[model samples]
Target: NAGVTQTPKFRILKIGQSMTLQCTQDMNHNYMYWYRQDPGMGLKLIYYSVGAGITDKGEVPNGYNVSRSTTEDFPLRLELAAPSQTSVYFCASSWRATNEKLFFGSGTQLSVL
Candidate 1:
């Protein structure tokens, strides 16, 4: 969606490599989140930032990192890619945690070999 954008819709990574999943939103939402979904699984929060310069870990944070230097940008970083890390990543933003009017990116599919 235009409101939330995620680059590199699909990716293949070698084990031990690193990459950053870019997510940007034009909605100016205060709360942004990074979620991962494995096959047949619901979205699992990897990280979230309430505002710029403030971030915290979520349900799944191992092998991943995130930073919110600006309200429009929240990038998720995989320091060391692994097989288990391969999944579909979705970036979403909401004015609050109430899930009202939450906007989501198309999603990025990552495969690790």
Candidate 2:
């Protein structure tokens, strides 16, 4: 089982361009989240899904969208890439919320030019 896998490990987007960062986990976790980590800052939640049909906005959901149509996938969409959005994007999952440990992907390094 591939715990968590993200594609296009690195990307460079021009201003206003759009892209989708793919995320998938094989652990069958019910709690999935997308977070961005900026230099010297802690992880900021972008979007999260409690389950397959429930999604919610998080701390930094301004330029992102998410969908959880299955137990293993939770992809994040960037409608208009901006330089300010440049950061490391991580996809994480947990079997349960309370006191559960999260499993994180290596992350996608995105640069907006």
Best by TM-score: 2
Give the per-residue lDDT digits (tens) of candidate 2, residues 1-113.
68999987999999999999999999989999999999999999999989998999998899899999999999999998999999999999999792599999999999999
Model 2 stretches astray by more than 4 angstroms: none
Model-by-model lDDT, in order? 0.94, 0.94
Tell me the deviation in Å of residue 36 in model 2.
0.3
Q: How high is each candidate's TM-score? A: 0.96, 0.97
Q: List the residue pairs that clash in candidate 1.
A: none
Model 2: colliding residue pairs: none
Q: What is the TM-score of candidate 2?
A: 0.97
> How many residue pairs clash in each candidate at the backbone level?
0, 0
lDDT of 1 by residue, 1-113 (tens): 47999998999999999999999999889999999999999999999999999999999999999999999999999988999999999999999663677788999999999
TM-score of 1: 0.96
Per-model C-alpha RMSD: 1.1, 0.8
